[model samples]
Target: MTASMTSPDTARIAAITLTFLLAGTVKGVTGMGLPTVAMGVLGTLMLPAEAAALLILPSLVTNVWQLLAGPRLGALVRRFWLMMTGIVIGTVAAASFIAGSGGVWATTGLGAALTLYAASGLLSWHFTVPPRHERRLSPVIGVVTGLVTGATGVFVVPAVPYLQALDLKKEDLVQALGLSFTVSTVALAIGLARASAFTTTDLTSSLLAVVPALLGMWAGQRIRGHISPATFRRWFFFCMLALGLQLLLRHLI
Candidate 1:
């Protein structure tokens, strides 16, 4: 009875680990996409709430690592403080309604986010936010991004596009992304906890998935120079686009 009952769980855990491994590798090579890819892939296997619960630990740890590894943490924080605050507010406000729904709405929203993200990548779109505009727009962008994160557990969309438009030095941009993602992850975690979605088994599974995430990152770094990031990104976005469309169609149909 024990083995029989445990079998499905064991397989599910294995699948979770592999999903993070792949997601982490993408983050390693491209410097982002961990949550987007993980949520996208896992959406196929489980409810968005369940997937969000499993995502907490690995996403938090990895984003923290990324946050600290950068050179301009202090300045990034000072500059983006308002935006982060907006993220907290927006996420907290929307969490109950969006994540708690965890049904057709959440699934459809996730699909929409993935499709938007993938479309941006595939188009190689470039946007520029001027310094004067940054102050005015950061908070708005944060709130919108948080709403999306709360709904879909993916925090890309306008936040990334806005950040990219900032015209920071490459390293600073990377660090900024880390800071934004870390804040978003923490907020999302809090929202999940408040929603009572993090069961003990799910928490353990989340913690265990961190190992595979790290391992995948290491492997991706080793192979980074050998593989063309551009080519890989094209393929990755294509896959995400297809998966996103599938999710939307599955529930709608």
Candidate 2:
């Protein structure tokens, strides 16, 4: 509804576009920041559920590609069934309970989650979940990850670390993240629908947002060819930390 340039809504539309562009670029280079970046910024401007709704289509599209592009898609599914089950169930349940409520708790939850994510990145913490204990720990991790996703529209944090801990090959790790995100996206959509947080307009906006995200990904890939990854990641984490702090402060105050 706010798409016109000179219709008194130019600034808002511009902000949304810029946010999506930046979110896309982050994901393009970092391979996992679209939803996190988008939600972090958008949550400041709108309800958390609305922000989550806007990311649905873009996140689904990117992660679907990420999932399909990897080796052993079927094999991976078979291997991670328990974890996947927990994620789906937890996301659905949590979202059903927390959806459409963007009060202090939601803001603080998102902020805390962001801080935790950034801290891990800042510290370069690599928690390793050994193969022997993978099955035992995965379901628990999946449930927690799903709860976080349901609450904040972010599916990384613990899930990414859990996947990283597996110590899979680099490519495999990326694919695993994709798989997990794709599933989370689907469950999130379902939960939003149940909570009346999703609407036709939101779906349309989300679909349109996919364009900027993909374009940014292309640009980011080109830029990544020129920049130092270490520098980029450090900046990314710091930025996330700052935004997290702001959110927390706003909520606490």
Model 1 sits at a Cα RMSD from the real structure of 1.3
Candidate 2 matches the true fold with a TM-score of: 0.94
Off by over 4 Å in 2: 1-8
Candidate 1 Cα errors over 4 Å, as ranges: none
Residue clash pairs of candidate 2 = none
Instruction: Report the C-alpha lDDT of model 1 over 1-253, residue by residue, as the tens digit.
Output: 6999999988987899899999899888888888988999999998888888788888888888888998889999999999999888887666765556656789899999999889998998898877888888999999998898898888897889889988889889888998889898889888877877766777887899899988877777777899998999999999999989988788788
TM-scores of all predicted structures:
0.96, 0.94
Best-fitting candidate, measured by TM-score?
Answer: 1
lDDT tens digits, residues 3-74, model 2?
474765666677778888898898888888888899889878877788888999989998898899898789
Worst 10 residues of 1 by lDDT: 94-103
